[model samples]
Target: MAQSTEAIFIPHHVDEAFEVSYAEAAPDFGPLARDRIPVRSMAAGDLVALVEIDSRITGRKRVKYFERKLQDALSESDVRVSLVAELDGVAVGFIMARVDLGEFGRVDTTAVLDTIGVHPDYQHRGVGQALISQLLMNLGTLRVENLRTEVDWNDRVLLGYLDRCGFRPSQQLCFDRSLG
Candidate 1:
């Protein structure tokens, strides 16, 4: 597929600017499951459902966080990627990421996964995997080279899931200092 060289503005709080283009859907990877779960690009109306899914998974409401993240992603459609998995037209899982080019002086284009959540009822039902698989397909359409995310070191469940998804320790180390 031919690529376009349009500039994208990722928010300064996360990273700098980059050239981006809307991705076209890649070839289907066969049916993702016996029970078909539809995953698609997030629409603005998905906000409430997304927040509800996350809240159910975490056992707490985080309306503002999701609101801001969704707004940012929708505002910068060329660079940010947001996807939701639905069963019978109800959202059960979601993943949000933004494409970064040369972030921190690196040249390769990377997708920084900001957040992903699967409702507890939907866990182990391939919803999360389906969401990820579709995200990867979409990223390939945009020519993104890698997918990066941060997870708490002690969160073994998430780590195992990522491992199964083919994630390994990245060459770049993350540093942090507590502000007291």
Candidate 2:
């Protein structure tokens, strides 16, 4: 069978904003043996798993901090979380987002995909693309206007992914400092 690049083997449903119902249920996409990459909401109990994967893929120093923040963010009614490519209930990669229903000072409401990471062990396996594409599709489904994410210069893989999602690199800098 010709596999689908975008379709996940685990079973997934889209109701109100794509919040996960239960990790206990079979993945909406399908079996990992079929090479399908499933992206599902991450649970607070999954924090350690999230941190370990994120640190390796992002090459960042503060894995625990970010993981904790993500867990905290998920607690809010306005926030949402997602994970990707689970070999079986274990999280292989993940994405988390915040859908601010309130309009920004001068901007419309937005779905900010705070983080998306595929464990270094699973890079280049289309997990990252699947997760991002899923997130963008969800945003479109919600009729959101603006989407923004911060990317480090060192994380070129992520920058490239954003570009593929039709996000441009803005030339404007909010602030900068010099140590001279």
TM-score of 1: 0.79
lDDT of 1: 0.79
Best by lDDT: 1
Which 10 residues in a row give candidate 2 its minimum summed lDDT? 25-34
Cα-lDDT of candidate 2: 0.63
The superposed Cα distance between candidate 1 and the true structure at residue 61, in angstroms, equals: 0.6
lDDT by residue for model 1 (73-158), tens: 89965675888889887889999988888677789988888889998998998888788878877788888888889999999999
Q: Each candidate's TM vs. the true structure?
A: 0.79, 0.66
Task: Give per-candidate clash totals.
Answer: 0, 13
**Per-residue C-alpha lDDT of model 2 across residues 53-153, encoded as one tens digit per residue:** 87786576676687666656677646463445576677777777777765435456676677776777787777766676566556666776667777888
